[model samples]
Target: MQESLRALLELQKTDQDLHELEQYKVDIPNQLETMETVQSEAETRLSDQESKVEDIEKNRRQHERDLQAAQEQVKKYQGQLYSVKTNKEYDALQAEIQAQKNRISELEDGILQLIDEAETEQETLETIRGETESLIERFGEERTTLESRLSAVDEDVAVKMDERKRMAMRVENQVLKVYDRIRRNLRGMTVVPIKKGACSGCFHVIPLQVVMQIRQGRRLVSCESCGRILITEEGLEY
Candidate 1:
């Protein structure tokens, strides 16, 4: 039983190393994705603003063309007034010319308003583009540094994993199971030393009888309060 308990300690150490390595693998990729998301969001916002500004400018140009056509119609009617024969004919031409002039005035007003809106939209587009570019540059440098650190962590995890596998092979199945159970229950800490006659694994004080049994090292003993396999601080070499 004592040998089995010792094997449990060894198994716990191996599993702990494996757990850390697994977490490291997950962390590196999550960090990379977060950086990518930030860059993508900035770019998307910049593009949307640019598209809106372009639409505004296009509408402004169309409005200007409509105003020009109205003005040209007014001019054509005015030029025909000189060729009129009777007073009634002249009056009809003059009325047509006045209607065209009013329509031109309304179109011109609309064009001016569209131009003003386009200019404001263009300024907003430029601001967003500048902000997006700045973020891309800053994020590029930060991502490089983070990726370098992640690579180093991955290499370290690989080396530790090799050592953990060797240790795992030395322990028996039942002992490994108990070690893993304790690790899961205790938040990844399965092996802990006894200190001052108390179980360091759970901080429970060991009775005198159980303490003596642990010291003899003939059979495995557990903490009365915590159910963890107990080991003495003295008498045996780790």
Candidate 2:
């Protein structure tokens, strides 16, 4: 019984190591994707801000062109005033000049407003761009560090897996089968030692007879309350 109990304990250790490795394998890819998604979002936000800034700049230039054209029209009207021979023609020219002046004023006001808006937009975009760039840099560095640590952990897992494989070979097939069954039912922990007259796995008060049997390390025994395989105190680390 003691031999079987010892074998079961060893098997559980190997199984736990295997479970950890499998879990790590599943988690690493998810972590990498999460990091990449954050970086992508940051870039997209920056691109949107840049696009808005560009639109503002283009509109500002168009307004400037319109203002210039208005000024040219005023100049042409002034030149025409000197050539006007009739009062009616002179009045028409003056009215046209006045209309042009009003139009120029409107355009100038629009241009000024656009310039102010563009300045504000440019400043906002710069701030957003700077923040995005800083976050990108910080995330990149953190991701690189995380990747390095994950790589090291992966290597360690592989080493531990190899050790588990070696340990599994030492235990009997029957013991491994029972350990696997218990592990499936109880998640990863299949074997737990009796601690202070209680089952370590479930913390249930173990019967004296069961505890005595477990201490004897004779045939494998299970917790009557939780059905988890029970081990003796010596089964676990001292």
Candidate 3:
């Protein structure tokens, strides 16, 4: 009984190690996904800034065309002024020329404003492009490091699983089955020592008779509260 108990304890250690490795493996992909999300957001911001710059350039071009058309209208009105016969006709022609000039002035001001906006947007886009490139480089480095860590974790889990199998073979078939069932239900804690007259697995006080039997180490004793196999501190050290 003591030999089987000892084997089960050793098996539990290996199984716990394996469980931790498995959890680490599960978390690696989530870490990678978070890094990818950050990179994607940075790229999206840079793209939007570039699009803003392009739109400003298009608006500036349109303003330039409108200014040119207004200037041409002013030239046509000025030419018509000389052909006016009456004073009223002359005054109307002069007023038409002044109105076209005002339109040209407004278009010019709009073009200037567009030019300033385009310049500012271009500067912002360039800054964001630099930041995005840096972010990509940093994420690339982090991914490489994470991949290396994942490879190492995979190797460790494989080694621990092999060790667990070897340890499992040393225990009796029935005892191993019980241990497996308890471990599955209890999250890898199949064996626990009696600590302070209580079941260490659940911290529940044990009856004197149960503690005595666990100390004897002649038979298997399971905790009534947590259903885990119990051992004395001496049994653990033995």
TM value for model 2? 0.81
Model 3 C-alpha lDDT per residue in residues 1-238, reported as the tens digit of each score? 7888888878888888888888888888899999999999999999899889988898889888888888888888888888889999999888888998888888888988988888888889999999999999988998999989989999999899889889988999988888888877885477888888998889999999988887777778899999999998666553
Please give the RMSD of candidate 1 to the true structure: 4.6
Residue 116's lDDT within candidate 2 is: 88
CA lDDT, every prediction? 0.76, 0.78, 0.87
Q: Which stretches of candidate 1 lie over 4 Å from their true place?
A: 1-18, 86-89, 165-177, 184-187, 192-238
1-238 per-residue lDDT for model 2 (tens digits): 5555565667667667767767776787787788789878978988898898888778878878887887898899899999989999999988988998898898888878888887898888889889888887887787797778777877877787788777777766776777767777776467777788888888999889877776665566788887788876776331
The most accurate candidate by lDDT is 3
lDDT of 1 by residue, 1-238 (tens): 5566666666666667667767867886887799799889999998898889888878878877887887888888889888989999999988988898888888778878887888888888899889889989988888898778778877877887787677666666666666666656666456565789799878898887887787777765666676676787763453
User: What's the lDDT for residue 53 in model 3?
Assistant: 90
Worst 10 residues of 3 by lDDT: 229-238
Ranking by lDDT: 3, 2, 1
TM for candidate 3 is 0.86
For candidate 2, the 10 contiguous residues with the lowest summed lDDT are: 1-10
Q: lDDT value for candidate 3?
A: 0.87
